[model samples]
Target: MTVHGADAVDAAQSAGRTQLVVGRSDIVTPLARERARDTGIEIVVGAAAPAPRPASGPATGPVSTRTDPTPSTGPAGRLTSLRAFMPGEGPPPPPLFPPSPALYRRGAPLPAHVRIDTRAVGGPGSTPTSGRVRRVTVVGAGNVGMIAAMRLAESAAIDEVVLVDIAGQRAAGIALDLSHSAPILGFSTRIRGVRTLAEAGPSDYVVITAGKARTPGMTRSDLVGVNAGIVGSLVSDAVAVSPDAVFVIVTNPVDEMTEHAWRTSGLPTDRVIGMAGVLDSSRFEALAAQVAGVHPRELTALALGSHGDEMVIPLSQATVAGRSVADRLGSGTVDALVDRARNSGAEVVGLLESGSAFFAPGLSAARMVLAMVNQTGELLTATVSARGQYGIDGGYVGLPVRLDRSGLAEIVEVDLTAAELDDLQTAARHIGDRVGALDGAGAR
Candidate 1:
């Protein structure tokens, strides 16, 4: 079929054509251009008469928009590399996809003065579909990724949850395994696993878990150099396809890696958050709940600063049943709990003798995913660029934030005690120093 309108474009793609000859009457629509890009089909428009179809396979050359007499007026479509002008269609395009500094350009930050409206934020625990979120993509179908993918599928908020990994067959297998559970779990959300990032398409929320895990006797910092490279490449590739997607980084050395992601993807800092504080806060809360003889759900806790051992767990602010933890538990007991929370990941790494913590991390990832997908105003902890917040500049740190569909809606700054404040300052220095180091190496 000669490609003309949207229907013909679909028909050509449906028949698996390598190239399409543009007739004098054929008009290319936006969807046709997109399909051409996705399938790498070269569109040849005739100069004077009807253009001829190419040989076989895929066509390789610049798509031309010369003095060809196709009858369109105005822009046939977006003036992009793969798209060309048609002679039909009138009036100019109304400035489509105005480039956001966060998207195309680098070194720009989200405006600091943009006020966050509380009521506009979505409810985290609210049942699904109050917004436009339809798909969630998890990069890296490893243990943390697969489990996180499963949790998103179970949420019933998204229509499709995609799992992408470099290990093609293994990721596909994990996706297949989770897909089978949908029937028993009573969820309509489809779970699919693929080998490449392009296959995931445009996702509302992208949870990046595609990096190395900490092994026994290895500090989260120890995996930084390797994982930074891994996270950088993954973010670059994933961002190419899902340009509007919000990123939730779950890779180790998360604080540094989060910064790495923001710079590499050149996305707005708020939309590229690291999943350190949520998992760390959950651990702290779970331990506090156990010690205080309360359910974890009953305890509300905040773990801020860095994501690792240096994280600031403000016990004075943490409460269970509306009662301060400090009032219930003595300083000695609370100190022990904080130590446990800081060492939680290391403990699991040692115990497993191979794999690190999966269940808790995956749950942490899912909780964060829910907050973003539902546009929940729920105050949660995430690692985002610290623009002088807690005296941290030009680096990413874990802190309390109100999440919404737009990602970090507002940075919730709870007053910290002198000691907690000091800890946060130190973490800022640590993260800043390492971020500077990464910059020197051109890691970002």
Candidate 2:
């Protein structure tokens, strides 16, 4: 049957047709090809229908290229061959089986009329990008990274989550293990693991958790120098494939490592962020709710500063079911809760006697990533560059921020008590000192 164009193809598709058969004379539009590619419909045009093989398989003979001369349809005669499959050297494969992008990408010359859509291809050209991240790449594949990948994969909005790490086998194994739960979880997000950042392909967002975990008796500050190096390498690798990717840094010292990613990638200042405030604030709210005898969701807590012991919790700002937590728990209990919030990471470290927290950190990292991908403009605490307000310049520190697809959409500075402001300043100074040292030592 004759078809006019994409509209006809759509009509046919709506009528439950699974394949499109066209002659060499037919004009198959690009939209038709694109729709076919997306809808998994086979296009069988130009090529003669294949002859059925015998029960025992068809008799074989030497194959040779030939042309059909019996009848002419289109201006150009259909090229035929003795073999069942069409020759690879002939005209484009009816848009049914287009040339493998791999051929053009591996230094292989592109065939005629087959220029790579740099926006559609992953490698060997401009980095692929679209409106927002259907794909989230998680760097590290450690406890936090792995957990974040799993959480992202569970999101219905995400199409893929690629986990890349230096530990290739481990990453692959974890990916495979998580894949088994796809049926159980009823999610369609594809999860994969790769050894190299390039193998993760291009992504709209890259969540980074690729750094050494803090040990017992250690502050998040202690990981600054070593994690800075790791973050620099990871950010550089990610930027190579995903220049526009919004970065979510979860490594400690998160403030400094986020600064490293921002500087190393040279992306827009708003595109790189550290994930401390969410985890820290979540910890605070949970502890506050626990003592106040309320649901954790009813309490809202904010932590300003670093992700470590020096962080500040404005108890005056905290609310439990719309009332001040200080009013509910009194000043003394609130002080202990604040201290616990500051030292929560170390507390987890001590309990495990090895690794630090992953559950809460992973939850926070995933939330930040989704906020960016979904462009929710949600408010959360994250480590961002210090500039514009408060006069703190040239370092990363925790602050309440409005997050969206662009990363740190807006920095929200809540009214801080005098003591809270001093705590934030002290944390900023420590981060500045460490980041400054990194710059001086050329570790950055």
Candidate 3:
């Protein structure tokens, strides 16, 4: 059956039909596909209708410049042969089928359109954006960076994600692998790999996961010196190209590295951030969920302070189904969860023996980047400058903040017990000491 334009959709709607089936030869206009998606009308393409025989008469049209001596006998094949086909000469034909119906749920409403800021440059005579042209760059191409890049590309929020590494070919290989998966994963985000940060320039956000990962016996603190040098240089180079880009620091000793990045980039405190607390909070939520016998989504948890042994998980703010976790699982079990959350990274390192944790860390970093680019104003834990929040005067600390394209939009202050506040202050002081040592070593 031939499917016309949006009229077909209107006709189907009027008929109370939820789906339309068309033959392969039937033409479904672009407007029809869009209308189907908008109105929850499923379009399925079946077999092609057989081409009818031409009138039993000689052809009257002008003869082709070239003749095919061995044209096929089939009517459809003959018709195709008669046409003057040229490659790469015009717009491609639309797909016979639309995207999977799951994408356009039968009863679900379409996603709300995001408002794009027209003031942002889109070249000389560009129209307002459709919120699909943002770019992100993930430096390092290591486990963490690779996972982060994959997550970002899979998000499909940004138009492109450039993966950079010192080993250019390795990055390219990883990008190629991820790019190959895009068709299967159903994302249109472009992935590119490059040797230099220069090629990843003009990015909207830069995620720095380049650093010496901790081995089985090493603590995150042990990576400070080695990773500081790596992170500092990457931030400097990235800032030179992406001056307005938000820098996400995912290197080890994250709080200290975040401070070093902030100081090195000479960008505003809000622009440079660290991915630590979110991962830690996720760990805490997972453990709490196990104990509470509830899905992790049902539990709201927050882990603050530094991202190391000194990390503090405040029980006051953690709840299970709106009830305090402590009340649900007692203070004893909750304390045990807190301790485990603090040492979760080391536990993973010990378990892997050769590599540190990357899955959660990369996902956490990607989540922060998505929140920023989408301007979702999501409340998240990030390592940002401590401007006297929680009585911590300087240095970077993990705190709850709202994220946007410009990075940290607001530092959300939640009520904490006196003991929790003390622990947070202690963690802040530890981070400050580490950052000071980096300064002393001129690693900043």
For 1-444, candidate 3 gives per-residue lDDT tens digits of 343567887897677665555653454544455565555555555533332223642223322211132222111011111111122224323322222211111111111233323222122223223365478999989999999999888776778999999974989999999999877877778899999999876998999998889988898889999999888888989988999888999998898889999999999999999999889989998998998998775566678999988888877777675467889999999999989988999899899989989999999999888777655434578898878788887778999887766888877677788998999999988888888888998885
Compared with the true structure, what per-residue lDDT tens digits does model 1 show for residues 164-216?
98774887899889989877877767788888889888888889998888888
TM-score, ranked from best to worst? 3, 1, 2
Better of 2 and 3 by TM-score: 3
Better of 1 and 2 by lDDT: 1
- Angstrom error at residue 177, model 2: 1.2
**How close is each model in CA RMSD to the real structure?**
19.8, 20.5, 18.0
Query: Candidate 2, 212: how far from true, in Å?
Result: 1.3
Residues forming the 10-long window of minimal summed lDDT in candidate 3 = 102-111
* Deviating ranges (above 4 Å) for candidate 3: 1-130
| Residue 354 in model 3: lDDT | 92
Q: How many Å off is the CA of 416 in candidate 1?
A: 1.2
TM-score of each: 0.71, 0.69, 0.71
Q: Model 2, range 1-444, lDDT digits (tens) per residue?
A: 243345655775676654556653343443454455444344555544533333553224322112232111111111221111222324332222112211111212212233222222221122323332568899888899888888777765577899998874888988989889888876667888989989889998899988899888777777877888888988998999998888998988887788878889989888999898888888988888788887675566677788776688777567665456888889999989888888888889999998989999998899888666644434577889868555577678988776666677777656776877888888899888877887887875
Preferred candidate (TM-score higher): 1 or 2 = 1
The regions of model 1 sitting more than 4 angstroms off are 1-129
